[model samples]
Target: MSDATTISQQLGAAVHQNGVMNSTGVLERLFSHLFHGLVYPQIWEDPVVDMAALNLAPDEDLFCIASGGCNAMSYLTARPASVTAVDLSPAHVALLRLKAAAAQHLPDQAAFFEFFGQADRQDNVEAYDRYLAPHLDAQTRAYWEGRVLGRRRIAMFARGFYRYGALGRFIGVVHMIARLGGVNFTPLLKAQSLAAQRQFFDSQIAPLFEARAVKFLARRRAALFGLGIPPAQFDKLARDGGGDILPVLRERTRKLICDFPIAENYFAWQAFGRRYGGAGTALPPYLEPAQFDTVAHHAHCISVQNRPMTEVLTRRASGSLDCYVLLDAQDWMTDAQLNALWEQITRTARPGARVIYRTGGAPDILPGRVETSLLNRWRYDQAGSEAGFARDRSAIYGGFHLRRHEG
Candidate 1:
């Protein structure tokens, strides 16, 4: 089958629940199309919080959605036995494979960081050719080598790679709107205290949400498809804002900007600056220099698959996996789908195995949806969930849940 056809089929299985004649179905197709390419240049789910909740050990195995593959790569720092990372987007799968190859082959931290950290240097293309290209599979190689507007896609590394993904473009639009409103986000980076950050947001950034145009666009689910928020997830987010998305967005933005110091929150840097802050700035664990060797050493333990989590768990033996990181993908699932997924999760979970997931709204999604028989097998850590949710530097998700298998 053709690549496009294959992508559609994969996405359709997970995302298309309503008929094409319905608005929900149309939104689903549109999201699927947008997601066919890179959606998250950097996964927003904080791996630090994820690792803390999982309390991973060297012998345990993990299964996680590989959005931008950052968390999967970061998990390697914990020296897990294996990380099975899955995604429906071919682009995401290819990106993870590329990161793995780079981790294994790149000469040093300087070269590696220049390619992925600076991500805008022309030498990155040459480095990819010299160091990374030969190790890649034919599919991944072709993905990076493929031309977009007369330039190879790998050259995106040479042209600000983080700024080209769907989420990146959405942030770019937000920046544009801020500029039009005479609001400057750069000043937030300069704020030395949380009080100062709050002052800047209150006086400069918060009013942008009150704009009629911003409110109009916020109400439409399509506008958030760029953030990888599907129609199903958008409804839950709106419900958080009392039937209006603007308040939810504004509050989320406030948390992102003011709840954490900019120097210590890479998510904030990505949102306001569209790139990672350098030097003293916080970075994804996988990108930290101290963790580089460990990541490189454990890179071989990660396996990237372009598919759904339930399909993968179904193929595993009972009690095989010790950890599962669902991110926010469950927010897109139907009740039956959620139950099917939880069935596989319960069937494959080892004793004391933990499952972690986030929701678009402030509640665990599994109860009353998955069978009580299946749900009862897991012990929900309400306090841990609250703690994880509070510490999540990304500040995009409304709830973070941690559940341990009773087995």
Candidate 2:
């Protein structure tokens, strides 16, 4: 067998066996795919929560994972000194590079929005070829040259890829099954008042957990993990609902659908309507048009490396970062892994640097660990963190922590 094929098989096997990708493994696999040109932008993270956690200032330098580049671009709105985005996904790196190119080179905000938000249009590819392609590094440029879902040289957002990717499609299937079970969610989508929204949620959405299919699905720990819930997390999510999962989930979905105007929330649109209004009309902060210029100028500050949190932290100079958004990645690690991560975070963090993550249970997982002396350089605002955690619409995360040490 060819060495390249053998390597690919080994990597895939490792990922399958490990249940999650580590830093080096992620990097090697990502580079292999980048060389071949397959990518997915737009991870299923809540930017609102992440941005709030950052509490960024104009002079602070930022470091983040460039998952689809949306959050990285969004961070620019705060006017930080710089943002260095790292990722283990080659496709993600290419997308970030392309976004930087578009933000820098696109003549107007409208054009930029059209290419990314109204991605289904063919003109976006032309725009990429004409305006954005030349600026990309060789690795990224070659990566974008390949076909996505059989279409050549397409942007993920342009091909309706965001709505069709693994997470997107999974949500779609869940919506379909819910509908099939006589849960008509149309009213939840159109509710004009929070009262009415709450009513719809209580009546229509909450009962699905008792459905035979949902129970069957939830029973499979492995399947739940794909929803980003690990075994421990699934147990926690289940327990958070007082051993009743349906009511809690229904209420969360109701808030997402009915809390705001359908136009203002891309999350709701993606969840219920399946698409955002075409072409850039004030998206989430991270996807906003006003910040594109800053994102473009600071694109070089981003990097994608395949290394663990410990390794990534060690590479940074002491007191170099302002924020760390873990995105529930910790749920996949062991105590030793957590200790390794904390060691690096404690070492590299500037005084007052924040660390935020979501948990599967309804409480902060690291209070004792973060509050202790060896790491107690950091402090946690239990009250404020709890409030923010309650406000999260995704409802999947149990806690949202913001930790900073006094200088």
Candidate 3:
């Protein structure tokens, strides 16, 4: 079966088809449709992991791929002069714009929390209509009001906005699988320490990997579409797993479900529990009430653009941006594209400009792939990168890279 529609712009179709699942025309189309929508209802990468790598200055300008816009919102805490959030997907750009509007206009922290932090309340609808809709650009407003299949997209907030996007539906399926295996690990959400988390995982979640049904289902590449693992990335994961992706998935899921304490681990809460947590829970930085005023004040500094990031950098003035957040987009680029991206990054970066990205497989996806002339301008921070990868709460990505440009 064909799984892609049209590949996301700037992601070469030639690469998409070389892989098994994405090779067929129909499958390619399916991937296109999935990519075109909200892949990450909440982002998969941890911003705190990133914050430790890319030390920001107040005068700096940062360019980031606004996947679900979570990190962008969180990055506002860094007090950068500006954060340019771009994406090839129009839907994602719309999502960023809507979030920015809500952050800027929502009357109180409680209202804002209910709308985005809680993310599953009928009041969010009223909050959207009252505080956010008028502030949204025409494109974004239309997107929220638009219909997907038959349902109006705006109503998704009332029904649990976190549960609607491609990633949301994907997580839902994983829960269904866990239920079928008779291993409900939801009790782990109450675990007080990493020791407790590990104990729970061993007793409850670990057995699923041994189950015939799970091992059978996990072998298929198509099963992880909701996790937004594109075909090229899926190929990387499959090889790392020695032909079957089950082992690779088990290790990553272990990190997500067990390595971190749930009280501070919002990513695990969302992935397994589908909600952030009850009141007084430790949440993502942007969701913390203390940070709300700061994010709102700086929300004006963000601009959402629907375009390929490489093209945006190519068009920018020399030495304009101080940082770039690639967010695993490099995994989708061909060698030529990767070099071109580095060329633009080198040209536009001020002295000490940092580039941070995650990889589905290799940490050094750029060393051979990117042109030496362009790659030489930057130095990869191996220590910081390794630490970020280890400390990352998201646990979905295999590599976290930080490179600094020298003008």
**Candidate with best TM-score:** 1
- What's the CA error at residue 44 for candidate 2, in Å? 3.6
Better of 2 and 3 by lDDT: 3
Give per-candidate clash totals.
0, 5, 14
Q: For residues 212-313, write the lDDT of model 1, one tens digit per residue.
A: 889898888999988889998898998888988789989999999889988899999988988888843678988988899999999999899887888888
The residue pairs found clashing in candidate 1 are none
lDDT against true structure, model 2? 0.64
TM-score of each predicted structure versus truth = 0.98, 0.82, 0.94
lDDT of each: 0.90, 0.64, 0.81
lDDT-sorted candidate list, best first? 1, 3, 2
lDDT tens readout by residue for model 2, 243-329: 755545555565675555555566666666666544454265645655666665665555554334566678889989888777675
Candidate ordering by TM-score (highest first): 1, 3, 2
Instruction: Residues 207-239, candidate 3: write the lDDT tens digits.
Output: 889888888877766667778776678777777
Q: Model 2 compared with the native: what TM-score?
A: 0.82
Which window of 10 residues has the lowest lDDT sum in candidate 1?
Answer: 273-282
Kindly report which residue stretches of model 1 are placed more than 4 angstroms away from their true locations once superposed.
Answer: none
